[model samples]
Target: MKDRRRFSRVPFKTEVEVLFERRRLAAKNLKDISLKGLYVVAPERPPVGEICQVKVKLTGAEPPVELIFTGEVVRHGPDGFAIVVTETDLESFAHLRKLLSYNLADPEKIEAELGRLIR
Candidate 1:
């Protein structure tokens, strides 16, 4: 069972198509993602603490999100390797959070803004 707080792992597996340092390749069946880091199930394990950029597409969202950040390899397994994202492009992450049912202070804020615009 994965924890649901702090470093909350996503429910479904994802696909991380990566472009790293002039090299373009795709990893299959990404496991989980969180604010702290993401776990990628990859066969070709990069060296531990090696920083690499990754692009992951969340399920049910149009246009795959591009993540240009550094990741360090933490562990390697027979089926895949686990990577810890060192840095993240939070700008995109924030936007995605909004799309994924993020709570707004007031749901009618948008309507209030629109009302002001009309007046």
Candidate 2:
């Protein structure tokens, strides 16, 4: 199958809390993340096309802020579900950018992908 990914993903295991509709779901296994989305390993998977809010708390941030991301559920399997990022606040975006930069060997690749997405 042809790969349809826009941005490269990196391992970013962390605590993830998702607000699915009016229900709150928590997962400890956040498999990976890209500039565009998240892959969460959980017991429950929301239906495809459902929009959800994902939050990742930053323990190191001096003021303490969580990276909030709003995205649509694109795929789900027995192990986990995938979300395609649709919205993010400025602060969260900055935090995500920095996290990806720190994890990726070639940080510029993520930036280039962001540029392409913007255009």
Candidate 3:
């Protein structure tokens, strides 16, 4: 299949601290993250088409940068669901990209790897 998404996906299992509507919730792990959205393996799946705010607290970061995105649950399951951010917060997205780029070990190497995968 031809990959159409304009985002590179890194397959890494990381535990993330998620917050929705000021409510603390736990997801299984992060499935993938792009400039547009994030997929998580959460057991407690939210209803599809429900719009909510999400904040992801990632490890290896000094302080948690709140990611304010208006996303709707697109998929529902026991494992997890897919959520696409309706609006792109440039500031938050840049912060997240920087954070991920730092922990990626080698930015150039990973980007090349993802490029191959995407192609």
lDDT of 1 by residue, 85-118 (tens): 6666667556434432233445454345335434
Give one digit per residue, the lDDT tens place, for model 2 in 7-100.
9899987889999889998998899999998899999988899999999876776887689999999999789999999999998999899999
Assess each prediction's global lDDT (C-alpha) against the native.
0.59, 0.90, 0.66
Comparison by TM-score, 2 against 3, better one: 2
In candidate 3 the C-alpha lDDT for residue 33 amounts to 71
Worst 10 residues of 3 by lDDT: 109-118
Model 2 TM-score relative to the real fold = 0.92
Better of 1 and 2 by lDDT: 2
What stretches of model 1 exceed 4 Å from their correct place?
A: 1-6, 19-22, 95-119
Model 3 segments beyond 4 Å from truth? 15-24, 100-119
Candidate 2 residue pairs in clash (backbone atoms < 3 Å): none
RMSD of each: 9.1, 1.3, 5.0
TM-score of each: 0.62, 0.92, 0.65
Maximum-TM-score candidate? 2
Ranked candidates (lDDT, high to low): 2, 3, 1
